[model samples]
Target chain A: MLSEAEIETLTGVAGLMIPASEAHGVPGADDSAIMSEIIVSAERTEDAVRNALAAFAEVGDSSFQQSHPDEAAVLQTIVASCYYRDARVLVSLGRKPQPPFPEGHEMEEGDFSLLDPVRARGEIWRKVD
Target chain B: MKTDPIDVLIVGAGASGAAVAWSLADTKMRIVCMDQGGTPDPTQFPANFMDWEERRNGPDHISPNIRKAPSDYPINDDGSPIKVVNYNGVGGGTVLFAGHFPRLHPSDFKVKTLDGVADDWPIDYQTLEPFFAINDRMMGVSGLPGDTAYPADRNNQMPPVPLGKSGEALAKGFNKLGWHWWPSDVAIATQPYDGRAQCINLGACLWGCAQGAKGSTDVTYWPHAKRAGVELWEHCRVSQILVGDDGMAEGVLYFDKDGVEHKAEAHVVIMAANGVGTPRLLLTSTSKQFPDGLANSSGLVGRNLMFHPYSFTEGVFDYPVDGARGPLKSIWSHEFYETDLDRDFVRGYMFEAARGRPPVNAALAGYEWGTLPWGEGHHDAFRKLNDRIMAFCAICEDLPELHNRVTLDPDQTDANGIPVPKVDYTLSENSKKMLEHSAARATDILNAAGATEVHAGYPIVYAGWHLLGTAKMGLDPETSVVNDWGRSHDVKNLFIVDGSVFVTSGGLNPTSTIQANALYVADQMKRRLANLFD
Candidate 1:
């Protein structure tokens, strides 16, 4: 479990990675409720985020946001993984965040015209007799 | 009271194990199938239908090393570039496979005679062709039948799934390039077949299908085999094969869900465990009778391990390509299936048309690739990378190098106190060259299709799905582990009917061939039922 301060900073980092743009209708890390989800759902992300923060502090002698290491990479994966999958973020990007089962997505019937050109030049088999 | 031995014992009721059991079901022999993992709970599938992407990194990851749920066992793959990605359930790897069912080229069987690099299979494609049709009927393939890329008389069970916008774009590009592209032959059914549901195009085939549409053996063969009176012991991991003084396998020693060990005896023991599990089971079953491991006198039990080295490329189109709508891979280009004298590599790779993953995977990938820019341009970058990307992977053919292998680790043991399989593998020159060529070709196709940007995963993180060649088949016992019919040369009553017996790793998803070989081996066993040990 991360300290409350670390969670806030990590949330802030997530915002930076995917900040809000009102013009593009995209939700930033702060706008979404994915931070808690990241902490709870990501595999060992809490430890990795804290370790990254410590590594950053030890390197830069300044707080977190210093020289990011492997731990930082792990944190970024966790943050981005949970954040982008959030329903709010997906909706803002004109996509559905829901899993594509039960009520499946609207898949347009394939345009058979795309295969017209392909069908013209058919049977390109290698002759190895 | 000790129980009497059954007629046959099959281990790991995944694709191959199920195929072998069903193939011999008509013989009216008592067959017992054992699996280390049990039936997937219906409650767990909704987690896939609900929190699909979020659950992947947490527990649904295909790799046992990452998805260390109760059903998985640890694998020490530190020695390899690509770690093992498989499951332990009744369906085996098919539980998580994309169900792309491309068959091995006829040329694949004659590698030594045609290519002169790897050893040739003792049996040719024609010998396995009938079984391929048989397995296709059983698995219910979905594809156009007359694609000249394969044999003219290919037996497609149903029309292929409809290609989405991304697939059409990729197809147009392949057409423009004058390449041989066709709708892939997948195991998923389009309509109801043999008591299973139809394809709903949910797009998460890689993460176990929740609709029970995809032809994973759990839904396909397990039901049929059970009805035919095959006894399947789920969540029972076999630790050792008990071979008597006569050097014939008597039965297996397995660990149950409660970590209790039990012995099941049978007249014949067939190890249908996959490439890694099969060799690990053999190497761990060492005794005074066969000091080097049962049927390992050839020392080829765990050697010559081959995982198809992969190269992935994606095209970023200006408009949204609704890639999130079909079977994971539908349209594939096999133009360069055979060797070209001008090419640097001996064998070639296949180009499979795939879509960008759902939002979560894409977001992670975009961040990792530095494509999803931060702070100010984040929105545009994420939008551009999200629904508009069409991705594809080049699955290259890997030849068997004796040094590339799976060995037993002495220190790391599973919950059952059996040695874990340690993989020692590296890319060969031929595979590297093939990948380089494939990546360049993929980039060309993407560019040809009027893409605005192109991104590629050079190492591709292709974590060894089509595991093959660990316990290969051959005519000579000194050179291989199993014979032509998958019968262990050292122990006649012992058989291996899985991808482990593949002499060569073909440039396609391996389940179809693995299943077909299972049918062939089962047929051979049935014909020789009177003299099975001979």
Candidate 2:
């Protein structure tokens, strides 16, 4: 599960990239956080994944980071990898993911099409983890 | 290569586009309606509330919206000035739009005459009365007409969507305040009009009504037009409206579903690509004869773009009102629907109430009163407030201003390398004042209805839902893009028959008016078809 700090950081980046002020409130920064969780948690039940993140954060409020302490480093690593990958992809589509893979697992190249502008808007949440 | 000529080329397949096709079906003209996306099916819509978000965002979630079917509609979203949020399909926005069909008041037409700010529409309500009646019957509007703020002559039979629980609660407040309220005249069938079934209170029209109740163009007019021999080219993106040397529309250049560029010559062209898309096509069609953009000699092709300003007001009751227990919304109030100069506003607003849904309700409640939905002590609070929270949203009237306009994005383009529509809009002081007045009035009504916790929405300065008046029609050729009959001044055979042709920003949702206006103008075009060969 992703950490709160990672979620907030990813949300901030998504917000900076796609401002709610610009998109008429459709894919705002907060929506980016939701989108990011949806993609990584696609294999898991949405509620279980969200609840797991909440447990990791140690807070009931989804956005608060102060409560969640243990899940910080892992979430940050995942988000940082995703963000770096996205930046690389921006320069050239379908770029390989950056090193520092989760638990030293070999990372594989993935389709960014899954992150369609409207759907993968939440992918920014991957930036903080 | 020679291109086949079409008698009529309709550029969009949304509500207005589909309506015009149906209106002109009896004319026996070879009509070709082109949309940028594929056609949607209503049968695949998700009905369960729990699974709605999955259906709404996931690829498998079949949209109940009568829009272009999904193929490979590509949109470019980089750091671009143009922020385009639109769906191109057979039914366009009508597929996604929350169908709250309320007719424009007579005062909506003569805004300048009544309040002296925006320009007046060339055609008044009386002029469009017959077409409105015709449109209502065709769409099967369900409501008690006499209860509306500005009631019209009962010229057509109405559908039977009886007042739901949410409507009853909202009506109580309006009745207590002695304000004019009514059941919202929606396109949903109440008693199974035509072949569709009655609305079983699905409460998810935005996603798509699987009950076959909501009257989408695909269900109502598209089939009718098809039966009448209207040729519809789904997944055809109309890029330009070509004008001949004789100052008449010649044809349209568009790309097929597979990205193959093709030209379809037409005797007349009708651009119904909505307010944003319609204006962009006209502005982008710059040629040697009209360098400033086709039909833009008046320099008002994309100017005066107006979107209705919306403000949501919520109320929390003592017991569980079970707000999210019925069809989205069945009741509305037009009590403060007037251009009251005393309120220091140029236009009016309509108040509509709906049962606040879960996530949104929780987020809003938390945002307004700093209450958390999750935690040990929050379950009771959630049950107490969730069902108790009902909303009264004010759809504020925003008159069209020339400075508030839509232009082609100088920075970004879509998949076909066409610049997306860029909207440069800001709320006027008059609009602000009108929202304040509406909000204050809504608060008063909510309080009267015994709401314990009331939260009013913030002032909207940059809302974009009720789009209208990008290519307005007027009697003066110099001041307007199209004539009163919706024929373009620059290109005689080109017509702008959508919300873009609206002269004034009416104080109502522009869909019904757009549909009605298109029907009226297509009828006029039907009479002028003989001039094509001559």
Candidate 3:
């Protein structure tokens, strides 16, 4: 949906939105694989993406960074949608790259002793006849 | 087209409709339920895909207006502070509910007697206690007994869902304040029960449970009701109730999936649509015998609409809370659930502790709130909030008001060309005060839980999950639409068994109580089978 120049501009904006971090071992939204997915998904929202790109080109990178307008929301949504679902991004967020079901995560059992104080207080509800 | 008359007809196939159908199935009466949406496909649930959060924000959104599925009917909620949120499928709202099942307090039935505000219910908690227990077993409820918030008879079929690190942190805060907090009773199965699998902590209960652990009516009551010989017709939108010459309900006129109109005749008709849908259908079903609407002789069919006004206070912690790893609802505090003269408000609210947001939702919320800017500091801001935040929602009890109502819109019509429901609602002074107090109290709890920062938003606009009190039940025919047994005061053979029959909105999730009421109404019908019309 985007030309080479527009793709380059989107990559720059995407990088600004979520920069690559070596400490977190996660790639930025501008990473080639993630950006490819974003471009593919942008087809579904072609008009919004084109409008956002036009706004970015008009404002320049510095001005666009200063002002996050309605157009920025479109880019942000597409970037975030692709960025968060990336395998490295999921791992960096401390989540498994897989879906929630069919292999759901395990949760620790609650400490029943936490209720001792509450149970000791007894019933707090009002009684009616 | 017209069909042969059946013994009983149900307009909706939701939580209440499924319960009523299952309860009456043993009577061997030819029962038929028609739902606009078909049974949900678990394979397509959001939890099954990597882009689940995207689906949740799109096609699987809670609001019918936003979801805009073929089965959904558009609701004109532009004038209301809180928008209407519901599902049109067989499970109804349960398809997207978090499964936090809490029963009404005994005092909830006698609000007028105790608090002198709303009218008391014709039947009290004692009358519905047995029915609550019956519904619990059928839905595979999981909870620990001996919650001091209710009578001692309360028990669940399985143990409670695990109160994860997030719940534990919130519990410690409640303990610090010496308040009443309990592991919430949930409709999700904790153990393998009734041929359903145990919960695997998918943390996606609200977006449709792919694990089949959550007890949505589709998995619980509908299967049993069908097994017991109840026939359910899906993708059929009921437009109006057909009135006979003698002023009794004869049947309903509905449009099927292909927009083919059909007349379904039944000796007895039941309206199990939600609060908004029920009144909308009634107001649109006008005739010469009833110039105003069907079963609306009292002129209260759409009045007294109540929604449990909700607010959220979230705390961002430094340590890992794993807030996105389990069921959405874990622990709840009833610290301010009852009325106290010391407070500014007459009625009170419950503090429901909720799990944190997923990655995509967290990013979007950060942008919407303007807390996380897009450039250099964005990553740092995201790290502080993602999977580390815990939230508490104040589910406040809303008093019934004459002005807050569901009226048929003159302009808007749904895909099936039926006039849509127009919601006109405003926050009452009492509800405003309650939200203010709840935000402060929730902040105190979050601060005590070792939070780095806390933020509060009152009257959450997208949190209109609980819709109630549009067609309330009472003894006086002049004041109420349905009787205590859910029988319509005007139309002898017509009944309403949904949340519309709730006299007052309690400070808890109403699905449990709604099912119990349906069961009670079914029991009453069975007892009065010989003289049902009397």
DockQ: the better of candidates 1 and 2: 1
Q: On residues B346-459, what C-alpha lDDT tens digit does candidate 2 reach at each position?
A: 567788776665433343354336453222333334445655777778887777788878788887666677776667877688777877777788888888778887888745
In model 1, what are the clashing residue pairs, if there are any? none
Please give the C-alpha DockQ score of model 3. Answer: 0.69
Top-scoring candidate (DockQ): 3
Better of 2 and 3 by lDDT: 3
Relative to the unseen true structure, what is the C-alpha lDDT of residue B279 in candidate 2, on a scale of 0 to 100?
A: 88
Q: Give chain B TM-scores in order.
A: 0.98, 0.91, 0.98
Q: Which stretches of model 1 miss by more than 4 angstroms?
A: A25-27, A55-72, A112-129, B1-4, B46-50
The weakest ten consecutive residues by lDDT in model 2 chain A span A120-129
Of models 1 and 3, which has the larger lDDT? 3
Q: Give the 10-residue window scoring lowest on summed lDDT in candidate 3 chain B.
A: B1-10
List the candidate 3 regions with Cα displacement exceeding 4 Å.
A1-8, A40-58, A62-66, A69-71, B1-4, B369-371
* Tens-digit lDDT string for candidate 1 (B148-218): 67768697888887778887788878878877788888999888998878888888887787877888999
Models 1 onward score TM values of: 0.95, 0.78, 0.97
lDDT of 2 by residue, A2-107 (tens): 5666455445533433233321213333355444643463333334434445565354343443344334323332322233233322122122232111111111
Number of backbone collisions per candidate: 0, 18, 0
Ranked by DockQ, the better of candidates 1 and 3 is 3
- Listed in order, the DockQ scores are 0.50, 0.02, 0.69
Pick the lDDT winner. Answer: 3
